[model samples]
Structure formats: C-alpha cells, structure tokens
Target: MTRAALVTGGNRGIGRAIAAGLVARGVKVTITARDRAEGAEAAEALGCDWALADLLESDSLRQFDGAPFDILVNNAGILPSGSLLDNPQGYFDCMAVMVDGPFRLTLALAPGMIARGYGRIVNLSSGWGAFAEGLGGPNGYGIAKAALNAQTLALSQELPGNVKINAMCPGWVRTRMGGPGANTSPEDAADTAIWLATLPADGPTGGFVRRRRRIDW
Candidate 1:
C-alpha cells in the first residue's frame, strides 16, 4: 500500500518543505492550514491534498481520526505570551498551539497506525526546549517544546514495535519566525524531519535528534 502523511502547518516554511519532500518520495500527502486560500494554494502547488484545520481549536483534529496515515509530522507552532513573569494569556496560547493540539491529534491517529502495524511520528522540537540549552526561546516557546519532548518520550514507550515516535530539532531557518538573517533555509531545516519520518523499523525511538544524530534531551 502507498504510504500517506499528514503535515500540520504545511502551507508554508519548514512544514511546507517537509510536505514537498514527502510528495517527491511518492507518498500521498495531506497538508493542513488555518486559511483555505493558503492551504489550497499549497496543495495545488505541491500536488497533494489540503485541509482547513486550526491547531488552536479543540475539535479541529476530529476530521482526521479515521485517516490512514503512515507518517505524522507535528510541525505547527506559534510564538506568543511574552515573559513568564507576567503569567500571560499568550503562554497558554503557546502551549495550546505547540503542545496540547499535537498531543490530541496523535491520540486521534495512533490507533489506526497501530492497527496497520506501521507508523512514524515526528515532533518538531527545538534546542530551546533542551535543558542543556537552558530553555532559551522567548514567549514560552521553550516551555511548550519541552512539554512536547516529554510527550514524545512517553508515547514511544506505549507505541508498538512497528511504530516509531521521536522528536527532532529543526535548526533555526529563514522563515517568518526565523527572519531573513537566519542561517538556514526551510528545506535545509526540513532534512532532519524527513529523515526521521522515513526511518527504518530498527531506528531509535523516544529520543531527541538533530541533523540525523541523537542529541541529549
């Protein structure tokens, strides 16, 4: 059977690149975007399917609960809710977009994956989430990613032998959030994610990796 993949926030940036790479590999791809126009445009350009799903909304993922996807890339995120000192709304917003929604989506999809005896889950995490890096990103971004890392680890233990779940740090790239001066391009940042999403059954799980190599979590 042909493999299928769902890439969240795939209308642009690193998510977009991941979708493109998967399509090039002959995988059926469905990309989600909050905007219809953007999502449709991207799907047309990439020769794939598109869906209107907002990660911030609680029920946005219900529609995909029955889709048979061999790969899931949780690449959607937002940077908001300034300093932790303020205990602001954006902090919760960050968690909702980066952590909560992804977890819910995984829960909705993992069952089908297990029944099929094949699955690959890749969480797009960050160096900022690492204690070695001192949880450095602004706007609670670091905190949200750290929680995502924990989810990746916990899920790995429960997922079966044929299924693999891991987190990877897609290095800073020149995207909307990374700005123009960043050192990498979206496609370059997408390399590690593409690798993890297509790993062999024997590949590592419940680990944090960057540039295709294991890194401290």
Candidate 2:
C-alpha cells in the first residue's frame, strides 16, 4: 500500500532528512515549512509535495486544505537565544510551534487514523526534554519540548493500539539550531524517526525513544 507522510520543518535539518528517507521508501510525503521558496525547493528536490505553514498560527493549520495523511511527523521547532530570564517571551514563541501546533494537528488528524485502524505519529522531542539540564532554563524552547513529550505520551494512549505514536529525541544534530561541532548529522538523527514511522501495526506507543531505546520521560 502507498503510505502518506507529512513532515513539518522539512526545508532543512533533521526534518529534511526524515522526509527524504520516507520518500526513498516510496511513501507519498508532504513537507511543510514556513518559507515558501525553501519548502518548494526542498519538495521539488525530493519529488514530494510541499505545504507552507507557520505552525504557530492555529487557524492557518486548521484552515489548511490538504489530503489526510497516514503518518504525521511533528518535526518543526525553534531555538531562540539567551537564558530563560533574559528571554521571557521566548516561552510563548517556542510553545506556539512545539506544543500548540503539534497538539492541534494531532487532535485534528488522529480521528481519521483511528477510523482507518492504522496510523503513525512521530513527535520530535529532545534529550533536554527528558529532564532539566542546567542548559535548559525557563526558556520557551526547552520547556515547550518537555511539555511536548508529555503530550506525545498522553495522545498515544488515546489512539488505537494499531496507530503507533511515539516521541523521538534525535540527539544533537548538526543543524543551524544545533550550531557548529554538533556530533549527529541530520541523516543520523533521521534514522530512528523513519524507523518509528514505518513500524508494524503492533509496534510500541507512548514511548520516548532514541535509536529504539526507551528514554526517561
């Protein structure tokens, strides 16, 4: 069967790699990014569909006219600089993408998957999200990701067991957000994501995973 997959922030970074991997597997992939040019170019390069969306805009996503997908990968996120105290507004900015957007999208799309008796959801999380690293302060990005992990677990339980849902901690990939000298490549980070996406109906759910090993959540 031809499976459909949607990946957010697919213009670049780990999201791009995950989308490419899915396309390589012959999945009909749709990638979403905020930038039209980048999103279009990436989609063209990968021979996939592209949708322009700023996940923060709930109405924008809600009003989006698109085909229902069998798989949804919430790979979009942002990292604003500065400490939590210095960047108070950063919390809202981060939550808009990481928490609010994924929550709404998952809620909107899940019923279809349940009705069909199969679905795959990959909610991208972070190692920092597992616990309070001294690195992650009250910053919006960190907190939102942590909260996102919780949401992933909660949502997984609500879905049919055949609809496998899991959170992915991609490690520290060498993206613009990860900065220079980051150890993991987008390709490496994407491995677990693609693996989770293509799982069998009896696969695990409500788990936090990296390389298939359950993480502390």
Candidate 3:
C-alpha cells in the first residue's frame, strides 16, 4: 500500500522541501499551512493535498481525525525575538506549536498506526536544543525544540509495532526563518527528516540525528 504522509508548515521552506521529496518517493503527501492561499498554491505546485491548521489551536487539528497519516512530520515552528523572561507569551506560543500541537496530533494518530502495524514520525528539532550545545538560540525556540525531542524519545518507548519515531536537526537552512545567510539549502536540510520518515522496522528510534548521524541529546 502507498504510504500517506502529513507535513505541517509545508507551504514553504524546509517543510515544503520535505513534502516534495516525499511526493517524489510516491508517498501520498498532505501539507498543512496557516494560510489558505499559500497552502492551496503549494499543494497545487507539489500535487499533494493541503489542510489549514493553526498549531496553536487544538480545534483546528480536528480536520485530520479520520485520515490517520502513516508518516507525521512535525516541522512547524516559530523563532520569536526576545528573552524568554520578557516574552512569556512567545514562549507559550512556541511550546504550543512545537510541543503541545505535535504531542496531541501524535496521540490522535498513533492508534491507527498501531492498529495498522506501521508508522514513522519525525520531529524537526535543532542543534540549539541540545543540552551540550547550551540550548542556544532565540529564547523559546531551543526550549520548545528540546521539549519536542523529549516527546519523540518518550513516545517511541510507548508506541508498538513497526512505528519508529525520531528527532532530527535539519541544520541552519537558508529559509525565511533561518534568514538568507544560513549555510544549508532547504533540500539538504530536509534529507535527514526524509530518511527518518522512511526508516525500516529495524531502524533506531528515540534518537536525535543530523545528516544521518546521531547527535548529543
């Protein structure tokens, strides 16, 4: 059977690249974007389905209820500028999107995956989230990603069957969020995520990886 994949924030940047790559590999891909126009355009360009979802709102995710995707890419994120102390709402917003949203969606979809006996989950984490790396970056960004990584690890232990979940750092890609000077291309940044999303049953789970290599947690 053809695998189905859902990539959040896939209207552009790394998410879009990941969605495109999955479609190229014959996976039936669905992309979610906050903007209807952008989402529709990107879906048309990639020849995949699109959904309007706001990660901060739980009600918006109900649209995905019946479609239990085989692969879930939690790639939507925000890099709000300011210190965490001064920007409490920003921190909450970051956590909502990067941690809570993915957590809820995973819980919603995992049962179907378990019943089907196969699933793949990839959270687009970042090196900045690493404790060894000092959790550096825009205030809430690293903290939220760290939480996301933790969720990936914890969920992997609970999930059964061929379901494999992993967190990946796509590096600093030259996207709107990463700005124009970042070193990696969107395609290059999306590589490890694509790999994780297509892993075999024996593949490693609950690991943090970059460039197909393990990274410190």
What overall lDDT goes with each candidate model?
A: 0.91, 0.86, 0.92
Question: What ranking of all candidate models by lDDT puts the best one first?
Answer: 3, 1, 2
lDDT of 3 by residue, 1-217 (tens): 8999999999999999999999999999999999999999999999999999999998999877756799999999999889989988889999999999998889878888888999999999999999978898886999998899888889988987499999999998999999999999999999999999999888988899999999999
Clashing pairs in 2: 91-140
lDDT of 2 by residue, 1-217 (tens): 8999989898899999999999999999989988889998999998999988998777778743334788999999988777768887787888999998988888777887877877999999987787834326346776888899889888877777988889988988899999779899999999999999999866889999998888787
Model 1: per-residue lDDT, tens digit, 94-118?
Answer: 8998899888889888999999999
Which portions of model 1 miss their true places by more than 4 Å?
A: none
Model 1 TM: 0.97
Question: How well does candidate 3 score on lDDT at residue 39?
Answer: 99
Model 1: pairs clashing at backbone N, Cα or C within 3 Å:
81-90
**What is the alpha-carbon lDDT of model 2 when measured against the actual structure?**
0.86
Q: Can you rank all candidates by TM-score, best first? A: 3, 1, 2
Residue 118's lDDT in candidate 1: 92
Error of 2 at 13 (Å): 0.5
Candidate achieving the largest lDDT: 3
Each prediction's total of clashing residue pairs, residues at least 3 apart in sequence or on different chains, is: 1, 1, 0
Query: Highest TM-score: which candidate?
Result: 3
